[model samples]
Target: MHNITNGPKVIGTKQTLRALNKGIVETIYVAKDAQKQITLRAQELAQSQDVPIVFIDSMEELAKACHVEVKTATAALIKN
Candidate 1:
């Protein structure tokens, strides 16, 4: 969470999935409280690509880490 706050990242499940598919994500952060359907695809794709997945406690927590105003189900730190 601390690291993601200052690094290049993509927010939300869709954006994270897109980055993961493109092999640009180094690590993905998923909120444990988010709906499985909303986050499962990203998790699976990250695993397939060997990108690390870190689970935050909730969407609100993840949003704070990303410095976003709205709740986000997932986010990713992109490779530099």
Candidate 2:
């Protein structure tokens, strides 16, 4: 998504889950290549909250989308 690179965002599963619990995440991006255990809880929480999810091909790609240097299992765009 074009919005991910510049929008206010949080990267990695822990941070994403925190934002989701706080009700501030607009959308979540998950890397399919990541271990399921690493991403499962966040995905379930986002679904329960009705947040949209966009799947990325890999952790590296997700990092790139989030404009981060290190790979991440997930990232989220914070609600404006």
Candidate 3:
């Protein structure tokens, strides 16, 4: 969370999925309380691409950590 706050990051399910497919993201953060449909897909993609997925408690917690007002189901930390 701290790392993403200080660096490049893409938030939301669609954006994170694109980043994962493009292999631009080094790590992914998924909200544990997110919808199963969304989280499962993201997790599968991360595993297929060998990207690390860090699970956070909830969308509220994750969004707060990212300094965003809206809840975020997922986010990806992009490489430099």
Candidate 4:
């Protein structure tokens, strides 16, 4: 999605979770095939924070969409 480009973003699950927990994420992008254990908490946090979550087909697709060199399980676009 266009939102993934040219914005304050966190790539990978850990950073995404940290940003989500801190209430700084406006939206999160989760790989559709990501591990439930990893993405589940983040999804819950995002829902609680009223942030939107978008799902890509795969981790590789997510990373490619973000133009990153490595696969990313999740990512967040920061608030404000």
Superposition TM-score, candidate 2 onto the true structure? 0.96
Q: Write the per-residue lDDT of candidate 2 for residues 1-80, one digit (tens) a residue.
A: 55788999999999999999999999999999999999999999999999999999999999998888999999999999
Question: What does candidate 4's lDDT look like per residue over 4-80, in tens digits?
Answer: 87788999989998888788898999999888998999999999888989989999988987889898889999977
Clashing pairs in model 1, backbone N/Cα/C closer than 3 A = none
Q: Which ten residues in a row have the lowest lDDT in candidate 4?
A: 1-10
Model 4 ranges with Cα > 4 A deviation: none
Q: Which candidate order results from sorting by TM-score in descending order?
A: 1, 2, 3, 4
Whichever of 1 and 3 has more lDDT, that candidate is: 1
Q: Alpha-carbon error at 15 in model 1, in Å?
A: 0.6
Residue-pair clashes per prediction, in order, are 0, 0, 0, 0
Deviating ranges (above 4 Å) for candidate 3? none
User: Whole-model lDDT for model 3 versus the true structure?
Assistant: 0.88
lDDT of 4: 0.89
Better of 1 and 2 by TM-score: 1
lDDT of 1 at 4: 86
Q: RMSD per prediction, one decimal?
A: 0.7, 0.8, 1.0, 1.1
| Number of the candidate with higher lDDT, 2 or 4 | 2
| Predicted structure with the largest TM-score when compared to the true one | 1
Off by over 4 Å in 2: none
**RMSD (Cα, Å) of candidate 4?**
1.1
